[model samples]
Target chain A: MTLEIQNASARAGGREIVHNLDLALAAGEIVAVVGPNGAGKSTLLKLACGLMPLHGGEIRFDGSKIGSLSAGELSRRRALLPQECPMRARFTALELVLMGTAISGQGRPMAERVAIAQDTLDRVGLSSFMERDIMTLSGGERQRVHLARVLAQLEAAARNGAPGCLLLDEPLSAQDMARQRLILQIAKMHAAHGGSVLLVLHDLNWAAACADRIVVMHQGRIQSHGLPRDILTSELLHDVFGIPDGCIHQHCSTGRPFVVPHDLVMPEDINKRETPCILQ
Target chain B: MRAMRVHAGWILLSLLPLLILVMLVAVEVGASGAGIGTLLHAPDVATRNLAWMVIAHIRAPRVVLAAMAGAALGAAGATMQGLFRNPLADPGLIGVSSGAALAASCVIVLGVDMAQSGFLNGWAVPLAGMLGSFLVTLLLYVFATRAGITSVTTVLLAGVAFGAFSGALTGILIFRANDTALRDLTFWTLGSFSGANWERIGLLSPFLVLAGVIATRLAVPLNAMLLGEADAALMGYPVERTKRLAMLGVAASVGPVVAFVGAIGFVGVVVPHLVRLVTGPDHRLVLPGSALLGAILLTAADTIARLVAAPAELPVGIITAALGTPVFVWLLSRIHGADIPS
Candidate 1:
């Protein structure tokens, strides 16, 4: 396994936020943690990234206890993109991305760091925003800049021969449809390159489509953990998310699961329709 | 949109000539009216002695001391703002100046006679001031930080409260002091470069250079911290160590200056901001730019303070606050109303 969390629990503000969670991610695998808001999805990602200390369990990376490694060691091993991009400084997108390499000790010349930053920005569809002040960018654009920063960190680590893990919290919440797909594709590509990914996503269909394994969390506990094709049944969705039956459908063309909230329609309106128009 | 490519090195290089020009001008236009040329080419030994006294003993030290103090405060301000991740955070916001002033007042009021002591006479006041500032900073940080994250708002509020608390104590010290000590205390509190001499400058250099160099080195970590403490740690930047180092650097930079020159206002709060306007938000650029610009500004401000009232001389703090307020207000207005979190 590339990353392992054995019975990890964490508390925030005098309350336990993550409780007795055991999960592991192997190399070249994408694991998505899906849950409602405040269900400890973000907390789990943060704990795994070592941003928060675990109260009652051991976190290991490459079979060594996480707490034993120095901060630089841990940082060179994993990159996290937090939920809120709270960067309000007047840094250009390129400058912001270059800051990611700070943990790697700035041994590379400025030109090389700039080249790496620019390359990641290009991958995130922000090649044109290299010089633009981050403050001037829209929320979505700023999120992409942070995404590019994480990607740059991972790439730098990979070049050093450590295929690090990427822990992202809602990495695509602000993007449009095309960019969302692009972000997932980027995550998949990272995993395919011998890296590991633990993504916190809210959209169930996106999880089902992108994640090799889905871990559903509720009230700070994992409710289900398995392949999406087997675990993401109608009963689990209804129990975990309050989705009624006939709402989730396996796409005929793609053969992947998708959610259609057909239960929201009024009974009289549904009866008036000869056939449902959503699938058509 | 294309990124704006600002050559920070070239900008720093360009600032050198301007700073030197200001320093030279400041050295010339003192109340003594002894120009550098006349001082250099005195005809008689007696005249040369007098000229040297004015140039070396009076003018040069004042200018150099002002430069050192201003540069220290400005760099400290920039580092503090970056460390706290708040644009409005200043070195004085954490009560360093007030604490130093309080200690110095205690020494003066209590008749410590630092200048007349056996071995520590020359160094007593500055040492006490440095200790005072360091203690307050340590206490404030202890009370304000929790679980590695420092809430910027808490630090600011604590600074204000502690400043007022120390100011009140200083006021009590002043009330009990005799006429001689009172005059000295009043002048010191108003903040002037009046007693500048090579001795005080020598006393300040080690701390100034140490803090300045450390803060400049911290530019990258400070930028990492701009993303927030947690993110900075996750990025491999040593968050706790950076915080401790930046805090120590601020105290070391500001403490000795407050001990020697009293509380020179606004240079700490204003120069870094003006530097950022030119150098962008990169602390690497901002720190060095703040240092040079700060020295230049204080030198110029001291010159103006000496000449504007001519021989009577206004306090340098009065001049900095008078000039800094308007600029600070203009900066505030430039930000959109929505930018101020409602």
Candidate 2:
């Protein structure tokens, strides 16, 4: 099944934070949406997940309007692991993962669901911290637990060939190098199992290395959408990012994307002085 | 081998009966000394009847209502604290109880004589009181909830505004009331169970039980809520609706308690925190635990309030404030230095 956003937009405080934008995701595909700050990448994901009200446009899954689905039904299809997930209640690593399975399997025996949760924890490499409180875990560890919860959500949703999709808003913001790779690797597994993923990432190289496709966002609009090699060029990067063609990547044994500042080209020269810029 | 000793299972087992004990004891004992023996005696005996009448009819109703009030306030306080994500929040200080107080006060001060003169008997009082509480709470809730969710700051602000409006009206009514009425109104504002009777008790029992059941049922939902709405929602919770239902339940339950029992200050704010410390943020534990703890604290306070003056009486709210505030402060300090409620 495919998850699609049809002209989805979000208005906060009567101003459109995310204007009308359309996108779609195919099974086993991980798409990274990269944008400058305030580009509405996060809002788009929220709108699709029904976390935010539909200010305008419609979100659909497998050609069905998302608004038509029940809250429980919608949750069973896709899960979102939000960026700022500092919990008001700190659950144990196992308990946090248990929550993901709990929602879909609410009718099942509690012990049964709990057993599934333990398995998910083991899969996420958090079996050792199952009983450890979330507070004791460092930032990277918490992210793993959250990602584990997302995996459990999908696992519960995997009944009767249900669509398993994950929408992550900067899932790796506060993590170290190892944790970042670990999260993306888990996401890739979720996709390989016929799930779809829409990731909002600031790190272009990480996105390039992980995502099958990349979408570039600018000021609440999508500037370009294509394969990583097709879109992560010097021109698009400099124009949308104003990166001065400086180093963002380095030679990597891991075959990861890295940038080196070959020359410090000005935005004016890059854009051919066509667009008026206020930024210095 | 260790599978035999689950701490949570044992705690739940112990706590369930403790909840029942608090409820039964609070309703059984009173000025009549209707404790273990008296509660079980035959109603035909004169002393038994007198004790029964006093216990079941007089103090029992009041104590039952007090427990209901305490539970609702505690539940509401817990929900509001979660909503605002602030542990220090109190509905009275933030002004929800005052708003209800204002609404109820308007009925007590103004509607009393008119309803009596109409020969409607006491029905009009509760009706008017209920109307006042419902209207003010509804208005305040509406005012506070702008976006889908109700923030603590907005709810607190709206409560303050609504409370001030109600308080000012209460002042006006007090000024207009006759000397006896003014004196009576003073007791009502401070909160007392003196007027409690079986009819009032019977009338209130359903609301209390219904609300309490629903509130207790919210333990799991509330446990999920501690993760905050968005994360909870993504984890398969309907975020906005969960919040709305909780708010409605708290308001509907607590507004009446405030109306009946003046502002029983700090029971809501104090009990939940204490329950959380003992049981952690698992609402399955905290909600029921808070209900029992609130009932125990309020009933004890009410008993002490009665005993302290012996033949005279003190407002239960004062006793609760006098005792609860210090205990609450101690709890705050103990939970301190640890942030984010682990």
Candidate 3:
């Protein structure tokens, strides 16, 4: 396993947000975590990235206990893109991306690291936006700039013979349709190159389209984990998400399950109906 | 503007000479009418001695102290803004100046005997100011941070409270002061460079050196921190250490300057903003650039303070506030919704 968390529990704000969770990602695999709000999906991502301390159990990266690794060591092994970056400084996109290589690409020639930053920006379709101030860019464009930053970090780590894992939280939330596919392709490319990807996604259809396996979370616990086809069922939707049946369908070309989400079920209606599952 | 980003290194290079030029002008122009030429080539030995006395003993130390104090406040302001993640954060606004002022006031009122003694004369007030600022910064940090996350709003709001609290204490001290102490107190509150001397320079250098070193080391970490604390840590920086060092640097640097110069305002806030307008927000450029620009601005302002009212000078603080307030108001109006969190 490239990354593993065994019976890990994490606390935030004096409460256990993630309780007794065990998850692992093998090398070259893409796993998607889907859950309702406050289900601890983001907390799990933070735990996996070592940003949040685990209250119990252990996490290991490449068979080494995560606690044993220094911050520099851990960074070379993995990179994280948060749900929203509260950046208001007037750094140019290129300058922001170069910050990724600042630590990971230590001792590398400055020109080469700048080249990597440039290439990553180009990959995110932001080649021309590099000189632009990050604050001036649209929300989606700024998100892509940060995506390029983490990608640059991983690329720099790859030069040192470490295939870095990418932990992303709702990376597609700010992206448009085309850029959403672009980010998925980028994740797939990272996985194809012997790295692992663990992403928290809210759009079940996009998660099904990109993730090799899907994990559903409910109230800080893993409800189920399996292939997309097996996990993205109407029963799971109706039980966990309070969505009615018949909203999920298979895509014709890819055979992946896509959620239409057309039938709006109000909270009052959900309360009036017979409760299918107990929500904690 | 894009060209400025690419050539930020060049801008830093250019600021050095610009600072030297401003320093030279500051050293040349004064109400005493003593120029460098007079010191170098006077008509007689007695005239040259008089010029030497005015320039060497009076103007040089004052100008040097102004520059050093400006550099400290400028760099500390930039570091505070970056650490707090708020562009509007200033040493004056965040209670560092007022905290130091309060300590200095205590030394003036309660420790008058110690201030009169030869051994603890110069060391007492500055040391007390340093301790005061350090305590306030630590308290603010502890109060604003929970679960390793700092709230910018709490930092700013608490700073206002601290400033008010210290101001009231200083006022109480002012009420109990004697005639000699009252003059010193007024100077401390309004800020002046009239007390600048070689001894004060010797006393202030170590603190400035400590601050300069911390500012340079914090550049990259502060850059990463602009993305927020968690993201900075994931990118391999020790975010907690960065925050600690920044606070310590600000306290150490700003405390001595406020004690020595009497709480000069706006140099800390205005200098960094001016530098950012020219070079963008990269702290690598911002820190050193603020230092240089701050030195230039304070030196120039002191010169104007000396000249505008002739022999009787206005306090440098008044001049900085006059120049800085309009720019600050304009900045507030121009700020985008995205720049500050609601």
TM-score of chain A of each: 0.94, 0.86, 0.92
- What would the per-residue lDDT of candidate 1 be over residues A1-280, giving only the tens digit for each residue? 2999999999989988888999999999999999777889988988898878889998998998998988888877888999997876778888888888766534667778788899999999999988887888899999999999988876766664646898999988999999999999999988888899999998889999999999999989998899887777888778888777777778787787878777678999877998657583
CA lDDT of A257 in candidate 2?
Answer: 53
Alpha-carbon interface RMSD for all candidates, in angstroms = 3.8, 3.3, 3.1
Quote the lDDT for B323 in model 1. Answer: 91
Higher lDDT: candidate 1 or 2? 1
lDDT of 2 by residue, A1-280 (tens): 5898878778899888887788999988899999888888888888878888987888888778888888777778888888877775656777778778877776777787778778778876788888887888888778778877877777776765744788998989888888788789978887888889999999888898899999998998888899876787778768988877645453345544555554666766886866784332
Which runs in model 1 stand beyond 4 Å of their true positions? A160-162, A267-280, B1-8, B112-124, B142-155, B336-342
Report residue B137 deviation for candidate 2 (angstroms): 1.8
Q: Report the lDDT tens digits of candidate 2 across residue range B1-342.
A: 112224644664675576567657666655556664764765557777776677667776777676667667777777666656678665553454666666556666777777567755755545555566666656666776775566656766776676677778878888888776677677777778777776776777777677766665566666676777667766767666766666666766776676666667788888888776656666766666676677767767777777788778899878888888799778767767877443
Clashing pairs in 1: A131-B3
Candidate 1 residue-wise lDDT, B1-342, digit = tens: 222325656777688899889888988887767778777787877777877788888998999999898888888888888876666778887778888988888888885675457787756666778889989988888888897766656877899999999989998998899997898788778788987899889878999888977886698888888777878888888777777788789888888888888888878777887877667777878888888888888889889999999889988888888998998888777764633110
DockQ of each: 0.57, 0.40, 0.48
Off by over 4 Å in 2: A13-15, A54-56, A160-163, A245-257, A262-280, B1-56, B90-96, B115-119, B122-124, B144-153, B340-342
lDDT of 3 at B288: 92
Local accuracy of candidate 3 as per-residue lDDT tens digits, A1-280: 2999999997778888778898889999999999999899998988888888889989999898999998888888889999988787878899889998888778889999999999999999999998888878999999999999998988887873646889999999998999999999999998988899999999998999999999999999999999999999999999999998888888877999988775676877877887574321
Ten residues in sequence with the least summed lDDT for candidate 1 chain A: A154-163
Clashes of each: 1, 3, 0
lDDT of 2 at B132: 65
